[model samples]
Target chain A: MKKFLSLHSLLSLICLLLVANNIKYLFVFIMSRQKVLNEVYYEPGYQFHTFLPHLKGVEKAGYITDLSVNRESNDGAYLQAQYYLAPTILELEDINYPYFIIDSKNTDFIIRTIKETKARRLANNEYGQALMKRPAP
Target chain B: MITIGYFLSFLLGRLTLDRCLKENVRLLHPCAAALLALVSGLGLSALLTFLTFVVLDSFHRPVIILVNISAIIIFLFFNRNLYIQKTIIPITDWLPWTKFRWFHFLYILLGVFIVGVAYVIALTHPYGEWDAWAIWNLKTRFLIVSDSWNLIFTDLHYHTHPDYPLLLPFINTWIYCFSADNLHPIPMVTNIIFVIGCGGFLCCTLYQIRKFSFPFLMGLIMFTTPSYLYLGTFQYADSLIAFFLLINLYFITMFQKTKDASWLNILGLSLGLTAFVKNEGLLMALILMFVVSVYILIDKNNRVGKSAVKHLLFTFLITFIPVLIFKVFIAPPNDDILPNINTSNFTAERFQILYNAVITEIFHEKWCYMWIVVLALLISRIWRAFNRENIILSIFFIIYSSAIVCIYVLNGKADLSWWLETSLSRILFSLLPALVFFGVHLHYSKQRGAHV
Candidate 1:
């Protein structure tokens, strides 16, 4: 007994067609960005794992800290860096501790920021994630 | 040792159920029963853990052990008649390799090779690719040390998607509680079992539906599919959700065939567990309800009895209640819905981006050909002559595919392109087994002429 597309199945098929069209338009938009499509599409491997070992320094500090940049910044790597590390980082309770990663280029600016916050820079972690400790309240 | 104890709890819970167990065991072939049992083992383990977390003021190891043992004893006492079974049907009798054809041997060799390759890949990246470490395993760490379980859902743990269900992490925590070690292999082994569970469930269900070398061929298709293997190795919830979805569909079909309402309860239980696996699972649960309702209305011979529908609804609630309490009472707000989505940006251009990411992945991704196969089969002449048995399955496929596209399109602050690129394939992977099962059933029904 073949029951071809009872109204239920027919409606389902129509719904699927509408969804496919919706998907097609989304593809068109991405392809429209010919310049950065390849870069964004072929972005190599996950950056989180590479950044994982460096975050261990932050973990050892046992204190909540601020990043040099805002958490919601559009920078690709930094955005995901926060995404991957925030859970472990947020558990830190030391209000005096502030942290940010610094390279040779920005070390002075970061140290200045730490000073302004009435904190002192601790040793940089191997991965360069920064740590700061605040004076007692 | 922890894995063994948890596994035993699941086995006992499943084996000692008189009503659901009898119907499931009787309807399914022995091989299917064993595979489904493995999946049910996880279901029981998660349910017990959830109960312990909710009932007791604290999650002490001793209390959990006592609960587990007590459950087994009570279920065993109630199901004494089952242990006194008069007949036995060994799986060997069902699949006699001695009589296999050459192609059968080919299927076996290929299955082994594919599984071996997948295992090697799993070993290469033991902690799972990304989500496993960031979200699932991170939550496990919290559960391991935190005296307060509610901390996981706090704003402090916002990045971990605290609103998502905790079955995987809770089981991992249980393992850690016993071993007192943070070894990576324990979680890796759990993922491997899920991989095997997916493959085994697929083959056994196909065999139960129609016996031939066909089940082997379908199993090979599932095993060799790059995305299926890849995600299975990664400690992602996608594979676990897929396993739960398959078991749900299998039982639903059995219910359709036998008109036995008891199977609906089993179906409800599986659907509830699916919701606990991931947030996407909640959507899947809704789809199951919608699809089954349509099937009931369209069914001519046995329109769903009122009591049957009541039982289905009640059991689904019973299974979902713990998660509901966790969400409403304990977990933090879901970040995916708000702050992420820009309702104002829902435009044609945005949709174009969503389509490009999804279609490109479908074409270029090493895995995900099953979706194409499903699309092809839907339009084929064979599909036009709908076997009534597949009504629920067809509806399920349509609803799931539609729902996924809608969800991706509605993304908030995350770059749509990046989000789609990273997740679209895994989302598709979750539905792969069901798609493959649909294909197998279609060709199978056509070949055998309505045997099942």
Candidate 2:
């Protein structure tokens, strides 16, 4: 009993229990193929990758989205878009720029934003995301 | 190619440490030295990369590689004597393992299991959590792809925390200097190394001081914490801060024991690196410097002389040069923090909210009762908690925690609960390993002879 209660034994027991607890989560994490969590947030960015060629030499572009800016719910998609299309700064809601990246689920909202900003849709990935160009005035 | 870059960096670090220590029998332990080399090498590489950017106005990959290779050649030549002398005995020689214990096997198995879990997580979340893409890796992308890397500090990228230090991104940028493309795996791999490095370093340092059982236990305790592994793989700078903090604490403990000026110099360098990891690290470096300076001055045993203190401060300032240049010249003013500072929010109610949030986090399930164990240990030995050996750490925790609280309390921007919810866990997470080390050291110091 004394041996069992020794510092080594007690610490070992705690560690054993902790490891056992962690194994349960490990199995769950593996089986779930938790890559989906990343894919959900990253899909919009991945879709934007095809538009990178169109954005060449374009140093900065305005970003238009139906999602609320600066909110937590909107940050992931917005930031991911900004990350995927880098060296090309995505100025949120500033349509004064000559180029724009449209990320919105609503078809009307995308068309309206492009039309309102006097920009024409130049390229897009079919999942309701696109790149728009504004001709010189 | 990235692997080759990382290896060269590691070699650079090992050779640098070997040259600096120079066959100091009491100071060099193979495992501890190896761990220190990995971090220091990577950090030095990052600093060199930053300097290259400053000089060339771009991240010229070939030049970066050539520079690192040149530095490595210089270190190799200087460290040749170390190779010839055959110093650095194997860690097993210091251990008392005449016969294999079942406990040793169990510990090894646990270590392997933890590392496997970390790798699995890293592979799944290759881009890492939101901040990695938003802030850290985002900066790395700019550092690589942008014609003007200075643009990252402009108001345009404020959401990306432009004011934050650039050590992690610079390290990733250094790795990318080897590859033609910015691979997703680079940051993921880098973070995993830090995670494993922290655990390995903690285990080795403890083993070097108080061998075998307690060291393994501390390693297991660290590995078992779910958040430590999860946040580590998230590719954030918190893990880097934790690693540097552990290094600082280890060297501080060593300096306290041996009064070796070399250890004090290493502590200064480590603390300087800590400041480069994040703003919190800068705060920590200040607090640690103040506490350690006070300890040195008031030490009952007048072993540490003024010359030793000068060495410590000198090394700290020298390593801190890059951080100074980056902060003053490159990075823009912090929008979220410094510019928005206000004392109007420091009400009794705000303090109450902050207090509740901290207490809740202390008992959060993510910690796996580790904090509870620390609390229990403290309560059990309240008297010895502030002994000469432990008081520096005790003071650091108090002052640092209070400073963090003041940041939250005084800041007018960002909702109080929202800020705490987003950040408090990570702030605590960064300190968790060092906190555990202190707890174990305190317990063992009281129970046994003061080896730690």
Candidate 3:
């Protein structure tokens, strides 16, 4: 009659919960669960992201058009990118994407960046005024 | 470091033994409550990990998930059988299928009217802060593009701030993983939900703790604070941490009434999660753990001392494990990293640095400093409340609020000043529930819905 509802039973119950929770934790480790979500293509471009340097062309298109970070993709400061050593210009208009860090190569990096593929895309899609763009010099 | 096992052991040891609340009066079923909590907790936990792997392309350690699931299950088990017979915890209640009564209609109206307004803004606009773009979204993008998630640790440059918590990423990852879409609709949605949830939780907590009609002065103060509204729509973790901190405080207060040990564990757990969400709350929680424990020792003939000691140890070990692991092996040796904050390497040299960092910032910062103002307000209120003999509540506020401020300020350096200035004051949203308690002045003699 006294076999149940004792402190021991309660303790045992806790142990059970601890063990039950442990199951998922263990499965994730032992099973080596592998899952695939999306395909992300990152080609070298001069996109001025403080998080990751995108091809500069992609950045200019958005800057001219004033697109949000997520919409433009080249937004975040690369978490620990040594390339973006300068202070990033933080923006608030958009939450998902805010600011881009200037690349480290200074004037030369900016000048050499005119030939980027994404840059050409921006140049072609200009609501015209491609020549209005300032010379790299 | 205390493993999840030890934390569980401590909570289990302290779990409410008697079925006091559920003994006679009954409205809902306990088993039903446990079932509801278990399913949601498990699903959410699994979903977090599943999403993390999907987004980052690697499996994260399931320790926190499992711990949460365990805590929820145990709490539901004890909570249902003994305490307040309210089986439907309402947050995940199953009554959506039922036709609404007038009271239910009122609840719906309130939740929808305010949250709906917030959601509309989130849908149409982009986040406002540069941090959201430069850091949170940047990391999200990398995780989306990456082949495996585990590389996040090895690929240090892949992150925005290595010190930032993983919860936000996991949240976004969960959505991305299922839809198989890299572009982030999930984080935006999460930011929206987090804001709405914070508002909803605050309303409920204010009403429950004070037993009053809808809040007007305090609620408006909270809802319209510039940063409250501004950051809510942004993608940063500060607002989210504030929400978690408020909920954690609520849980602690409720736990006191029940004498349920699980509440303490849950409280500690929430702080840990909050810390994992943002460095600000983590810093606060750490300081409070120390101050509150010491305060407890000074009062009630050492009653608080033992409990405080146990809880402090457990809280430190359980809540800080991820950070510890990150600092120990994950975070590459950057001389810039705050060494004293990490327990695994709490050398005297580093500890002194941590101590210096905290003091220099606090004493040197002008009136704009958050800790100074909040601490001043908190101290006076504490003294007045104590004189009025409101001992327990005073101690509680001091330890909880001051802990985050003191610890983080101590750990921070001059470079971290911007981080502190931009955050601590704005993060007051985290104190919503606690603020509700402080301002709450209703009494049983006053009618249930009556305001002061």
Full candidate order by lDDT, most accurate first: 2, 1, 3
User: Number of the top candidate by DockQ?
Assistant: 2
User: In model 1, where do residues sit more than 4 Å from their true spots?
Assistant: A1-105, A117-124, B16-18, B56-59, B85-115, B209-212, B338-343, B368-371, B381-387, B446-452
Q: On a 0 to 1 DockQ scale, where is model 3?
A: 0.03
The candidate 1 chain B region of ten consecutive residues with least summed lDDT is B86-95
- Per-residue lDDT tens digits for candidate 2, residues B1-452, read 78888888888877766555554533645556677888988988988888899898876989998999999999777756666665552323223366456876865686687788889777767788878888998889888988988878873456788899989998999998777764577998899989888877887666655565555566666765666788789899998999999888877876776677777777787788888989989888989998888788778684767667787788888679889998898887677777677888779999999999989998987666767766775676567668887888888888988888888999877788888888888888788779777877776665444446
Give the residue spans of candidate 2 off by over 4 A. A1-12, A23-44, A71-73, A105-112, B24-29, B85-110, B208-215, B446-451
Summarize candidate 3's per-residue lDDT along B1-452 as a digit string, tens digits. Answer: 21232233223322321222222112212222232222223223423453335444553335434544565576657665333444423323333344345675666675565565555444434433556655666555545544454444444333245555566665554344445443445666667656665655555444443322323323333443333444577777766665665655544444434443444554555555565565666565665455444544564544333564565457545646754554465544433335545443435654455456556644542212323433443453443455322344455566665655444545533333444555554455456435544444222113344222
Better of 1 and 2 by lDDT: 2
RMSD of each: 8.7, 3.4, 16.2
Q: Each prediction's TM-score against the native?
A: 0.78, 0.91, 0.55
Model 3 spans > 4 angstroms off: A1-137, B1-100, B148-159, B209-217, B224-227, B291-320, B333-384, B387-421, B429-433, B441-452
TM-score for chain A, prediction 2: 0.73
2 or 3: which has the higher DockQ?
2
- Give the Å shift of residue B380 in candidate 1: 2.4
Tell me model 2's lDDT, rounded to 2 decimals: 0.78
lDDT of 1: 0.62
